[model samples]
Each structure stands twice: as structure tokens, then as C-alpha cells.
Target: MANNSDIKRRDFVKTAGAVGAAAAAAARIQGAPAIQKVKAANNQVQYGMIGTGGRGQYLLRHLNSIDGGRCLAVCDIYRPNLEAAIKTSKDKPKGYLDYRELLARTDIDAVLIAVPLYLHFPITRDALLAGKHVFCEKSLVFKPEEVHALRALASSRPKQVLQVGLQRRYSKFYQTAKQMIEKGMLGNVTHVYAQWHRNPGWRMRQSPDPKRQREWNWRLFREFSGGLTAELASHQIDVATWMFGAEPEFVVGVGSLDTMKDGRDVYDNIQLIFNYPGGRKLMYSAISTNKHLSLFQGTRTEFGEVIMGTEGTIEITVGTDDEPAIGLWFYEPGPPKVEKAAGVKEKPVIAGATLATTGRGQIGLPILFERDLVTGKESFLARELKYARLWLYKRGIMVPEEDRNPVDVELDEFFQCCRTGARPKADLQVGLADSTAVILSNLAMDEGRRVYFSEIEKMGRTPEAKGRKA
Candidate 1:
């Protein structure tokens, strides 16, 4: 929670513990006590991939787009996905029906395990034991036991890196927001509200074979996925955890699978409340109905968190690249506009003068501040400064944002971490914590009772790290 001005080139590295120690020790040997080195990869790391499904293909695209390491091979149980992976690979990375065979490759320095939630632990466990760094997707482990075990394995191999695919952790805008939050922009944030509403779940592939239907539409099942909670809610919950500067102590919720009567076991609408120890709460919701909440321009059903604070509120959404990261802020009714009754009214100045609507004088904006928006403008700094400086900005300047993908940034950061042997922002602990939220929340909804985060089996630690943010 350091201020922006205090953050140096390597300041971010200091935020992590074990990896930061190694980095700091290395810097010390060079007669300088740098805070720590960003746990970015040194470009010598080579990556192997497992699972070439659509998600896996997306990772492949990111791998090919950025440099840190190249994919030497990919593995999948399915033939079509393997074939697609081969075509996707620039080096025409070797394909294997068995992930074990791919892990055996000598050239592979790290592995990107992109399998479903059920397969996450075994694949990741095997990769870690193979002495390969791991970049697994979110909900790093499905059950409580895997969380304990994987964390222990990671601890045993302290030198190796393990990162979760919570992309926002690597985003520049999100990081900037974190910095802003730490700097007291929100003045003791109080409550957060978020929602993710979509239509008919995801389009299920037309399937004759039951196995085919299950494999392709894993998201719709309970045994395979936690529906939107693990698949979608995890991201926003992570944002809540980040912005609140702590993890929730407990969760309570109500959910029903009223819509999408398409034999999907997962709920269609879920409303959850996470309770932080500081008396703060995050009210979160997700529904697979009409994707219409008017947040993030309706591209997404759930726009973002409405971070309420003493000073003001911020709306944030880490959304599609075609649009951009969305955010806007409203200053709390500035000190109650006072009206002076000077001439003949015989009355003194009064506090309440002008009234406003709930979300007034705020602008919806692209968070990235893209290059095209900066062109023809003198300076981005000027635009930002001018808008913020005004008492009331009559001519609001547009914030520029990238029309391209944010996964690019997320992947690049992962590679950098792998090469440098540094801990990623979304390291093992962050992923597990987010997963904890999911598991506990689901429990809360199912049981019709409040579920404390502590109620779920805590991962890794034999004796809990009680009271500290999970």
C-alpha cells in the first residue's frame, strides 16, 4: 500500500515475501539494497502447455504474442484441440495426448495448465514436481484439500514460480487503481456492490454425444465448475478483496437456478454478501438472464464494483478489449453548497443549496487511455490534469483506452515473472484466497446459512494465519 511517488522501478517486488527475499539478497550482493526485483522471467524460461481447449487456445495466442518463453509442446486428451494447438503454435510445438508426455520434455522450463477446475490440481501438481514453473488459471484448485497440498508443494519448491490467471492483477489500470486506493482517494471505503448478469448461460454447443456436451460445456455443470461464481464472480471478488485492502471473514448468500432450464445444474441468479472484519461489506450478484445492467456499456451484465467511500465512489469493470477497462468517479457532494443571502434577505449563508442525483457529474470512461486518443492532443498529462483541476469541467476530455486485449499484458507479466524467478502479482496465495471466497460463498448459498471464510478448510497453513487478510 505504498504511494505512487514512493514506488520506484523495483518497489512492487517488495510487496511479496519469499520471492522478494531472494531478489533482495541478490541485489545486496551487488552493493545496493534495492527493495526487490520484479519477479519477471529472464527470457531463458521455456513453457509447455496442457489443455488446448478454447481457453488453452487463448493462452496460446498470448504466448505467441509475447516473449518470455516459447511453447515447445502442448498436451490435451482431445485430438481436435491438440490439432488446433499445433496450428496455433509458431514453432509447431509438439502435441501429446497425454500431458505427462509433454511434461517430460527437457526443453520445457514452465507449464501453462489450462484445463478445467477439476483437472487443475493434478496437472499443476505434476508440473510443479517436474521442476517446471506453473501458470495455472483461476480457481487454482477445486477442492479444499488440493489447495492445502498445492500450497505445500509450492512452499517446498521456493525457487520455482506459480502464478494464477487472474489477469487484472497484471493490468496497469488496476494497479494504478490500487495505488490510488492506497493513497486515500476514496477516504475509508465503506461498501462495495457488484453484479454479473448474462443471457442463457453460454451458448451450449449442439451435441449428440453426452461426453462431447460435457467436455465442451463444462461451465454449465456443478461437478466441473462453480458456474458463474468460480468462472465469473472470482474476478470481481478479487477486485473487492484488493480494493478493500483485506479479505472477507465470512460470506452469506441466496441463489436459485430459475432460468436456463437447459439441464444446467448451476444457478442462474445468485446474490451474495461478503463480510469483512472492518464492518465493510461487498454485495455481489450474478445472473444468466438478459445481459442488461447498463454497466460497462452493456457489453457485460456485471459492470463492476460501486466502491462507496466517505469522499466519493468509483465504478470499475475489467471488461472486453473491444471496449476498454471501464471506470468513473463521483465526488461526494462537495461540502454542501452554501448560499449567501447578502443584500436584503436578512438571512445568513445556508449549507444546502444544490441537490444532485445518485450518479451525477461523472463520466463513463475507458481505463486504458489508448494511443489513438492521445494523438492530436498535446499531452495526456494535460488532459488528465485539466479535467481533475476544474471545479466543474464544462468540456470533459475523453480518457484514452486500448482497443486491444488486456490478456496480452497479463501474459507478458507472467513471462517476465517466470524468467526472473519472481513472484507474480497473482501468485499462489492470491489465487487460493479468491478460491476460498468461491467455496465459502457456494457453501453459504447451499446451506441457507452464513458461511464464515474460516468455516472452509484453510489452505496450506497448519495453524491459521488468523485475522490477517486471507
Candidate 2:
């Protein structure tokens, strides 16, 4: 018998081979649309960036590669952030201290917002009212009222695009996963387990100036942040809800501020279970003490999700700045079917070779190809080639990857939508639903109760409801 270490080594080699082959094969794939360059003036969307903080700067780095949009203006309350944005950009953009000033420009057709959680609503609302298309970062709104408010505002501005910065929605790997789920590839996904464990947690920096301190450590305070839920868990929870194809009915959870004591009120650790329709559940955990992820056999860390079904399981995660997103599937093994002789009684055998013959751990199948690529419409040669590649993929000779990073794809799509008035994949409705989950999930932990997602319908009706926070 092979040792576990030896088996793992073999599995690793196969996985590596499959990934490399798939990546190489994807480049030469026929029938794929040619990559178009965004050099024409009519093809480009004029945009401004607001709140050029860490997240904002991160987006700017990605924006460097994208040409479909041009940054006409940059805004940040902090002078350094504004300067950094100006320096990072290829096109010279006017700098503003107030975001409203940036929004006032008529030349700017859209805005990319990467502000703190609390400011997400006010900024987005203001930008929409300014008649510019908006692409705001994730956990779209800060509070319940914002959810209702933004929805109403976005509905009124049907001409303008409002896209949320949930890059996974634009990822090919994720889209393929969604298609697989729809096609029963995973066989009735019943449960999803997600975790985002980070070491050291959010930095607790205190400035001599009170306002600066608050601005610097907004993530640590409960008033401005939803802690781990809004920052990390929201992404994974959205993935769960998306893959399940339904909203969660209710959520129950607990949160604790035990680990890092730095005068911050938000919890350092959290665990929640979302009960969706059809008896499906999404179990989640976020902790500050560790950064180890159990998915992909500990190959990746910090964040990932496990989708479990009757026939198989899928472990998936989106790409970071350094790592590309990956998805792997493992099929469940059942007892072998045996045919009995007609009218003959089966007897128990004293000696059994079943244990010796049975396979140990199952090898993971890469969730790679698009449904249409291997479907009925393609030419026989194309279909044959796809199947042959699939055969290689299953044998761990090739694994698939997206042609471009999701972040870049998302930004480019946002720009295109802004110009063409096309609806985005991660539009306002999806953003609002994700925000509602974040708000209610935090409330579930805070109030020590199982909170229904439907509560958001009536949540912001009154002043008291409007002021509710995590």
C-alpha cells in the first residue's frame, strides 16, 4: 500500500500537470472571440475615482492595465491618497479634496468608489444623483436604510449603470461553476462551508488626531465597520447564496472581541450558519488568529469555500493580487453495484477482497470548460478536441484557467456598461441582496438571535430601525 505522503505527492504532480496543460491549451482555444484593444475615443468611458485609500489604490494598480476607461479625476480626504492616485495614473487627473467636487465634473461619465463601509452608501447615493454611472466596492451599502435607499435611487436612474465590485461575478471560473451547478454537475449541492481566517487581524492604529485615528482604523470600530462579516465573510456568503441559487431564509451566529484588545469594539472572531430554502445551509467561520485555509488540501490560505452535494464536492476560491482563482471537484464514491443470479440466494463470503480492491481517496476533477464549448452546437472536430482535452483534464494532465483576472474583467465590463447602457452582472439588485445579508448576519450575532433576511423589508421604516448597527 502507498503511504499518505507518497499518495499526496502523486496527486500534487497530477494536479500541477493538469493545471499547466489547461492553461496552455486555453490560449490556443478556437472559436473564442479575439481580444479587442480599447484605444478609440468612442469605445472609452470617462471615469473618476473617489476615496483613494488602500482599496482605491489597489484598484488603480489594476486600472493601469485597462484602457477602456480613463480616469478624469481622483478624490480623497487625505492629501497623500489623492497624490498617490494622481501619481499612479497614466492620464493626468484633477485631484479633489471633496468627492462631491469630483462628481460635479460633466466630462466624467462614471465613478469608481472604494471608500470605507460607512461611506459606501452616501457616496454611492450622491454619485447616482450626480448622473454618473457608479461602480462601488463590495458589501455595497453600510446599513439597512442604505439598501432600500440605494435600490430606490438606482431604479430611478435606469440610464446609469450601478455595478458592485464583486469581481467573482465577472470570473470565468466562477461562471463555469455556476453553470455546472445549474447542469447538476455537482449533483444537488446541499451544503456550503466557507472560511476566511487571517493572521494579525486589522491593524489598530491610533493617531494623535482623533478624526485621523478614526479614519485610519475604520475597520476596527463597530460604528463604521461590520468587522469580519462585512470585510471578509460577505464575499464567501455571497458565493454560497449565489451557488445555492436562493437567498438564505435566516441566519444565526455568534461573535467575540476576545483576541486583539485595542479599544476596538468589533469582534475578532465570528461563526454563522445561514439556513436557505430547500433545507440547504451555509456554514461560515472567520477568525483573526490564523490564516490557514483547509481547502485544496492547505495549498491556498485566507479564504475559500466548499460546496457539498449528493454526488460530489467542489472547493473554490477567487484570485488575489498574487494568486489566480481555482476550482476543484471531488466525486463521492458509493458501493459497487452487483448483479445476483436469478432465483439464487446470496451468501456472505468468509474471505473478502472488496477492501483490497476498493479505491482510497478520489482524485479531484477540474471544473474547467464552458457548457457551450462541449455542447451540441460545436463542430465534430471541435467537440472531439474538447472531449480529448477533458479526458486529459480528468487524468490530471491539464487544468483550466481564466484568460484574464476577474478584477480587470469587472472594471472593463463596468466601463463598457457605462458607455453602452448594458446591465452589469453584479448590478444593484445583487449588490443590495449581498449587503442585506451582511447587515442581518452582523445583527444576528449582535442580538443573539436567528435573523430572517426578510426583516430588511421593514427594517429601515423608522428612525430606530434606520440607526441599527453591527
Which candidate wins on TM-score? 2
Q: What is the lDDT of residue 418 in candidate 2?
A: 70
User: In candidate 1, what are the lDDT values of residues 1-470, reduced to their tens digit?
Assistant: 11223222122223222333443365457642221222334544577788788889988876786756677788776677788998998868877776656666666777888887877877777666666778899888887767777776688777778888898776556765676577787688889888877766576676545546765677888877887789889988998898888999989899997757777788878999999978999999888776667554454554566788897677776756456666666566556576776685665755663444334455543333332223447577766654563423223444444444668776777777766676788888899899888888888899999888876655444554433424
On residues 36-133, what C-alpha lDDT tens digit does candidate 2 reach at each position? 22334867888889878788988988998998888889887667778899998888788887665676676778899998888787777666666678
At residue 38, candidate 2 shows an lDDT of 32
RMSD per candidate (Å) reads: 11.3, 15.0
What TM-score would every model get versus the actual structure?
A: 0.78, 0.83
For residue 162, give model 1's deviation from the true position in Å. Answer: 0.4
Name the weakest run of 10 consecutive residues (lDDT summed) in model 2: 1-10
Candidate 1, which ten residues in sequence have the lowest lDDT sum? 1-10
